[model samples]
Target: MQPQSLQLSGIRKGFGADDVLKEIDLSVRPGEFLSLVGMSGCGKSTLLRIMAGLETPDSGTVSIGSRDVTNVDPSDRDLAMVFQSYALYPHMSVRQNIATPLRMRNLSLGARLPLIGRMTAKASVLSKIDAAVNEAADVLQIGHLLDRKPAQLSGGQRQRVALARALVRSPAAFLMDEPLSNLDAKLRAHMREELSGLHRRLGATFIYVTHDQIEAMTMSDRIALMSSGRIEQLGTPDELYQQPATVTVARFIGTPSINLLPVEIDASGRVMALGRPLGVSVPARYAGPAMLGIRAEDLRPAAGGFAVKVLRSETYGADRYVTGHLADDQAVCIVMRQAAGDPIAVNGEGLSHLVFPEQRAHLFGADGNRIETTVPARIAI
Candidate 1:
């Protein structure tokens, strides 16, 4: 099947006075897996609903492969949506559930009745539907469960049935709204791998919505990080992790959450933290209060550097996470990652000196936007 591009422009939605989404514009490339991820009430789901034609935008255009679908019905838009709830019928067998969409689309109402409809429907059409259902079941590796009902299936099995239902359609694009949220952690992890592999096999356009950063990071070709009704950043996982566009993006995309330190940039653009030079400089126009962001993995122990009072440490098999507070300001805490057995140089007072290369740090202006910086030439030289 040829992949289709999905696009939305000037999307604005609100409930009462809330304004859930504001001027949202997004373009999903053909055969791309794009994830819309954010916290609860961030409007990622709403944006997805708009794309699927389940929720109409207040004033915007939704296009699919250069054709406007803004006013199209969900069924006629040729989009398949796999929801969080399996939504499978308890009374229907797995075969019936997976064949439901094709039946609705192909069979007339009179031809859908259990007994007489089977005879009225064309034998060739019925055979085609069965073949499609079986093919979808095989793709999802749920062929064995075809004879069962929803009630007899496990959480993972039910999810697979839901996916099979969606896959049977071979729609222009697939929109999934947290389809794996109900599974246990182990199963969720396993399904993540399966979903990624399935995308590679199908090569279809996909728009996925979820609040789990791990899911977005591991499965998506690119992630659109939404926050408070707007996209904080849209980029590859590495781009968001290595070079965040905003403080919110920096804070949301990382596992440990980037450590933010209160800082200031002087007239000379020198970055200062805890009244000490941080060995980095931003543009002179940003000479004022700022924030310095550093991921846990970036900080290293050094004999002479900024001091932090050790607070606590935890081991997780191969690595250790050490939590500490700035010696000068206990209100500011930081976490550092190191190999489990690596020794930390802690003095009698429970203080350790830590340092990070200037280029490894992120500087944000007082307005919470990222400020590009450079290692002072002398330091770089």
Candidate 2:
């Protein structure tokens, strides 16, 4: 097994009385691409900052390559980060910008000068820096843009220059904070493909932080889903989608999101929804009020399913959504929808019956914790 290149042990941070992060444990394997994702105010950005050594944590240890780097300065941590704003030097040429780190690192206090340095024999240092800068530009396909300043570059070009600047140093890992957020929707999608290809070419560890679930789902090997300053779940996209550990995670992921219905358990370990037997075999501990989580794909018209009137139908270009209201009262969970042309089940009068496949049905107990159980048999109405 490869050792982890980046590790955060029991990390925490807070702003005075407000807690921004709880004890968070994260690991990034060497050459692995990991994404930290969550909504606004979820501390995702804060965590990324901590990883970059830009923000000091209230408590916890940060280690890189088996060495503790908790007190290391951001610049001394030997890591490069790309910001969302693409903070390029407006007046500097692309080559100068890309060579900035190397110049800063290679030059001595007495040798680095505006006029005096030009007369000194620092040819070797300058040559090495130029080679590194050009090599990184070539790899990023930005060699042609080296002579242009940031003002003259397009958004994509600027982004590649920023990436090239970061990569020139050959840092241990790349830290990206919403790097693609500034791009338009179509460009963002295109960049996603390009970034994946770049990752393959470099084989370097990537730690990306973003609010976009699709970005995390498609690009990362695994994701740490954070919420309210704490990690809610950590797993693959399929794992979280197919088997969410809690209601929050289930609701957070997916295109249309999963529909959760209020339900109750009977004396025989059976779940009752809309005052009818669901035929779902719930756990013995389930009783009183519980919620039934059903994905849009799991929803259909019911022959014996709980009856609800259709409110409306939503149609997209390629898909039509069948959304409707349920007779049950309490909250909006009763309302549901599914893709059109689904053979699942629905009443003729816009009534929605959640007909989840026995193998696909998910059960959550009254405590909001998902209960592990098999899907209930579909009854033939």
Best by lDDT: 1
Model 2 collision count: 4
User: Tens-digit lDDT track for model 2 on 1-381?
Assistant: 222399999999999998999999988889988889889899999998998899999999999998898899998888888989888989889998998888778887666676787667389888999899989999889989899999999898889999998888888889999999998899999999988888888888888999999999899888888889888888988898999888888888887777777778887787787777776676676766887788876666666666666666677765666656566653464334444565435456555555556556677776667877655345423
Candidate 1 Cα misplacement greater than 4 A, ranges: none
Deviation in angstroms for 97 in model 2? 1.2
Candidate 1 deviation (Cα RMSD)? 1.1
lDDT (Cα, tens digit) per residue for candidate 1, span 1-381 = 688999999999998889999999999999999999999999999999999898999998999998999999999888999999988988999999999999999999999999999789999999999999999999998999999999999999999999999989888999999999999999999999999999999999989999999999999999999999999899999998899999999999887778899998999888888887888777788989999999998888998878999999999999899999999898998999989898778999999999887888998899888899888688786
- Per TM-score, the best of the predicted structures is 1
lDDT by candidate, in order shown: 0.92, 0.81
What are the RMSD figures for all models against the true structure?
A: 1.1, 3.0
- Cα TM-score per model: 0.98, 0.90
